[model samples]
Target: MDIKNKVALVTGGGTGIGRATSIALASRGAIVAVNYSRSKSEAEETVQWIRSEGGRAVAVQANVSLDREVRGMVATVVEQLGTVDLLVNNASITQHILLDDLEGATEEIWDELYGVNVKGMFFCARAVAPFMKSNKQGSIVNVGSIAGLTGAGSSLPYAVSKAAVHGLTKSLARALAPEISVSSVAPGAVATRWWEGREEQMNHLSPNLLLKRIAQPEDIAKMICAMLEQESMTGQILTVDSGQTL
Candidate 1:
C-alpha cells in the first residue's frame, strides 16, 4: 500500500472530489489516470496543476457507466501508466427533488442517475478488479455519501445509489480480502460545485456538526490518501462527516 511511484485511477477526476483526490495522489508521487466523462477542460487543468507541482498525471476521458469505455480506460491506464495499483471510485450523479415531488422523477431520470451512481460504480470496480487480482495487491476506494446512511436531506434516488455503493464496497471488500483492500469514504456535505448555491442549507446543518462547518474537497482527499497508503484497514466505511450525524 505504499503509494510511492504507484499508479492510481480516479473516476470523475475532472472536478470536485475526484479532482482533489487525483491531485493528492499525484503530489505523493503516484502517477494518476484522471478519468472523466465531460469536464474535459477542467480535467486537463487538474493534470496541468499536478505537472506544475512536479507530479506526473494524465487526463483520460471515460464514462464509467459504459462497459466499453471503462474497459478502454483501464487498458489505457495500464498501457500508458504501466499499472493501476489504486482506484478511487468517485464518479456519481444526483437529481435533487423532494420526496413529495416523486412523481416528477421520471423513469429516464431514475435510469440516468442509477446508471452512473450505482451501476457505473460496479463496472469501474469490476474493470479494475482483474488488474489488482493479477498483481495480488491493490486498493479500491469507493466514495459514498452520508445520505446513504441516514437518507436525511439528499435526494432519495441519489441516496439509494450511494447506499448501493456502500453495499458494493463491503461486498467487494469481503470478496477481495487479503489481496485487495476495498473500503469506502462516505462524506457529508462538502463545498463542491455540486452544492454551489446551497450554502444556506449546508451551513444550517453545519452548526449541529461537531466541526460546525462543511468539508472542503481537500479534507476528503487527505482521508482517501490515508486509505490508499494504509493497507492495515479494510472492509471499513470511513465517514469524514465532521460528526454531523452523530
Candidate 2:
C-alpha cells in the first residue's frame, strides 16, 4: 500500500480521470501502466507528462471490454512493471440518450456500455486477482457514478452497469478481504471530454452546483490514490459530487 515504486494499471488512461490518476501515481513514484482503446495520442501524452515529471510510466493499447485484450493488458503490464499493486477500472462510456430518443435503447447500446463499464471491469479484476493473491496484497478501484446511487441521469444501461460495479466491489471485497481490497469511487460529475456536446443549459449552470462548480479530473484521481493506499477502506464508494445529492 505504500505506492512508492508500486505498479498500477489504469484503464481508459487516455483522458479524463484515468489520465489524471496515471499522472498522480507516477508523480508519487509509482510505475503506471496507462491503458487506452483508440486515444493513442492522448495516452502517449499522459505518458510523456509522467516521464517529463521524472516518473516512470508506459502507455498500452487495449479494449477493456474484450477478455482477451484485458488479459493481454495485464500480462504486458506485469511484463513491464512486475506484479501490479493497484488496478483502477476507469474505462466507461455515457452518451446523452433519452429512452424515446431512439427505440428505448438497443442491444448495441447495452453491449457497448455494459461491455466496458460492467463486464470489462470484472474481467480486469478477475485477471488481477490471481496476481494479487500470489503477491499476498493488492487493491482494486472501480470508477463508478453517483448516477447509480440516484438511479437516474446517465443512460439506463449505464446506471445499471455501475450498479453492477458496486455489487462487484462488495462481493469482491468480502471475498478478497485480508488479502486484496476492492473499492469503488462513484463521482457525481467530473468534467471531461465525455461530456462534450451533451448538455447546453447545464453547461452554463456550473456555478449552481452544490459546491458551485463541477469537479476537475484530478479531484477524483487523487482520491483513487488515497483509496488504493489507505489500507482501512474497501467495498464502499466515495462519491465526489460536491453535495449535489445532499
Clashes of each: 0, 0
Stretches of model 2 off by over 4 angstroms after superposition: 99-102
The alpha-carbon deviation from the true structure for residue 11 of candidate 2, after best TM-score superposition, in angstroms, is 0.4
Least accurate stretch of 10 residues (summed lDDT) in model 1? Answer: 151-160
In order, candidate lDDTs are 0.89, 0.87
Per-residue CA lDDT of model 2 for 88-142, tens digit only, reads 9999987567634556667898888888898999899999889989889999999
User: What lDDT tens digits, residue by residue, belong to model 1 across residues 88-144?
Assistant: 999998887886678867788788888998888888888888888889899989999
What lDDT, from 0 to 1, does candidate 1 have?
0.89
Superposition TM-score, candidate 2 onto the true structure: 0.95
Top of the candidates by TM-score: 1
The Cα RMSD of model 1 versus the native structure comes to 1.2
Could you tell me the lDDT of residue 153 within candidate 2? 61
